[model samples]
Target chain A: MTFVIQLMSGLAVGCIYGLVAIGFSMIYRAMGLVNFAQADIMMIGAFLGYAILVAAPGIPFWLAIIGAMLGAALLGFVIERVAIRPSVARRADQVYLVLLTLGIGIVLSNGARLIWGADPVVYPTGLTHQTLTLAGYPLPAVYLYIAVVMPALLVGLHLFFTRTWLGLALRAAADDPDTAATMGVRPALATSVSFALASAIGAAAGVLYAPISYVSFDMGVIGVKAFAAAVVGTLGSIPGAVLGGFIIGLGETFGGQLIATEYQDSIAFAIMIGILLLKPTGLLSGARR
Target chain B: MESKSPAALALTGIEAGYVAGVPVLSGVDLEVREGEVVTLLGRNGAGKSTAIRVICGLLKPNAGRVELHGERIDGLEPAAIVGRGIAVVPEGRRVFGSLSVEENLLMGGFAHRRGIAPKLDLDAIYTSFPRLVERRTQLAGTLSGGEQQMVAMGRALMAKPRVLLLDEPSMGLAPMLIDAVFDMISTLAGKGLTILLVEQNASEALDVADRAYVLERGRIRREGPAERLLSDPEIRASYLGVG
Candidate 1:
């Protein structure tokens, strides 16, 4: 029973990492951008959700998720247009773009600090703190929420990318921007949409993660682990991101159980390095250049 | 034999190149009238592809005026040009390899429409290239070279373009595949589609074209009825490899 509880708990955390990693992989695929600010976007999303809850007092959790996603998407689009597009239009080097994203990340976190103050904030809901016992073992209710939500998100994303014209256009644009333009897909629009979508996903991850932990400006540090997950799954592969997330999440959980709890973070990196050294292209890498 | 139709697509005084002051196409003028197949015949590096790129808005001309059906379309983005119905099957068959063949066709019709159910357009493409029917769900990158070429052409056709530009349609194909490609071109022409074909296969191109232009070192060296160019001893020796 304890083992099963640990498994579910690991998977729940993995879902959060997977969500954030998807944003990383997607932006990388669409614009060849690393988007270091994605984690900060996630941080902003959590704050947005918290603000919405404070404003409304008792709105449903799902509504808060939607609000955060929309707010983050708008921010992401504006950031892409204002800060990123100029450098892109100039055909700046990849190193310069990476630095630009790093600067933006700093701006976002610091700006967030100015608005929300330095202290961490907690949700007012007591339901998230409730613990459920299954077979004489106590499990966090957030894990159950994650279990249901992750599958739903996966299905939604799968249908979106496979069955929608806009989704197909995004993939096409990422694959070959020049040919996609000839097919009537505006490259600028595609990049903007990609940024918006990635930021929304990042925000969703933040919302999902907030119930399990305190919402703070520095919580974006988790984004480093998610980055490790993206690299473990291959940089631009979607399914790989999810798989990488599970591996890191479960690995750390078991590693902490077997080894020392303090070494959990290092364990994630150890697994990532071991996997990269062996596969180089990641576990489920698609024809990535 | 000229039909006296107005120009469906026209390029006037186009001067363009990849690098500044090293123009690939210098003041080149060409036109494709409605329901006509106009072939641009030249050797590799003779600015044939460069002209096609300018027409499709992939490359902005240093100085030029591109017109479609009497309306100027120069300085527009490539997507805007595609929206205006000028579709190009670029030099290489640059298909979105990660996307399925059907998805690729759907992308071609992206200029003006929404929703996933553009069934009529997909049906037309599948009807034209029946081989694509079975492979619709397969990733484009997994296809053979000849099949990838078909997807590229079909993708452009999905736009229902007013004037189609084909650049090196016969490139990197087997002899038999090249013949099939030319036959498809001839078939499309018979359907009253206006076409601007760029080809190194001068003999085959001239056979299907109403008129032909021979571009030499960024200039129109010769242009006339396709039949006249086909019979020219100099053209036969230079491009047709016979006299």
Candidate 2:
């Protein structure tokens, strides 16, 4: 029973990492950009959820999550339009684009610090502490929520990408922008939509995560673990991201028993390096260079 | 040659290149009349592909004007150019490797997709290329080279384009496949689709085209009827490798 409980908690944490990693993979696949600001977008989403809850104290938790996702998506759209697009239009060097993303990440983290203050804020929901018994075993209610919500999100994303024309356009533009253009797809529009979709996914992770842990401006540091998860799973594959998240989360939980707690963060990177050394393209990757 | 139909597509004195000062296509003029099949023939670096790029709005000419039935289109974005009924089957049969064949066809119809009327029919496309019907769900990248070329052509045709620009449609294909492609081109022209074909295979290109232009060093060195050029001693020696 205790092992099962530990596994459930590990899976819950893995879900959070997977959500953020999806954003990383989406943006990376679309534009070959490793957006450092993606995790910080999660931070901003948490703050947005908090602000929304404060504004309407009686609002449902789902509504708050939606509001936060929409807010972060708008911010992502603005960032792509105001900053990323111009640099790309001018044909900036690849190194410059990478640095630009790093700089934007710094600005976002520090900007959140200024706006939300340095103190950690707790979610005002009673659901955080709520518990339920499943087959005579006690389980955190938030874990149940995470389990339901993650699968729901995965289904929604799958439908959006496969069953919709906009999704087809996004994939087409990402694969071959020049050919897509000849086929009458506007590359700029496809790119903007990709950024918005990735940001919203990140924001969903933030809202889901806030009930369990205190939301801080620097909470985005967890992004590195998610990045490792993305790389480990396969940088651009969505399923790979989710699988990577589980590996990291479960590894950390089990390794905590054998190793010092101080080395917990190092485990994810260690796994990432090990995977890369064995298979540089990643476990699920189709050998993309 | 004078025709009752105005120039369906025309490029006047187009000058363009990858580098700022060095031009690959310099002071080059070409035209395709309505329902005409015009072939541009040249050696490896004679700028045949560059001319196609200029006409399709892929590369903005440093100084030139591209026209569709007299209206300018050079400075427009490639999507806008396609929206105005010009579609190009780019070199190398660049099918979206990850997307399914049906998805690729759907993307081609994206411009006029908003209206209730289905301007482009998937069933029609599938019927035209019977081989594609069975492979509709397969990723384009996994297909053989000839199948990818069919997908590229069907994708371009999905736009219901009035003018079709084909860039080396026979490139890297088996001789049997090349004949099949030329037969398809002849059929498209029979249905009154204006075409601009760029080719290195001079004999087959001249066989399928009504008119031919020879480009050398970014200049139009020869212009005449396709059959006349086919029998010319100079063209026979330089391009056809015949005495």
Q: How far is candidate 2 from the true structure (C-alpha RMSD, Å)?
A: 1.9
lDDT of 1 at A245: 91
TM-score of each: 0.96, 0.96
Model 1 clashing residue pairs (backbone): none
Error of 2 at B123 (Å): 1.5
Q: Could you give candidate 2's per-residue lDDT for residues A1-289 as a string of tens digits? A: 5777777777888899999999999988889888888889998999999999888987888888899999999999999999899999999988898888778888988998898899998777776688888777787777777887899999998888887878888898999998888877788888889999999989989988888777889889899999998999999889899998998888776676468757878877888899899989888987421
lDDT of 2 by residue, B137-156 (tens): 99988899999999999888
Candidate 1 scores a C-alpha RMSD against the true structure in Å of 1.9
Tens digits of per-residue lDDT for model 1 on B1-243?
A: 555645899899999999988999988999899999999999989999889888888899999799998888989989889888899898889989998898888888887566444557899899889999999989999998899999999988988899999999999999998998999999999999999999999999999999999999999999999999999999999999997
CA deviation > 4 Å runs, candidate 1: A287-289, B1-5, B112-117
User: Pick by lDDT: which candidate is best?
Assistant: 1
Residue runs of model 2 more than 4 Å from their true location after superposition: A287-289, B1-5, B116-120
Place model 2 in a CAPRI quality band: medium
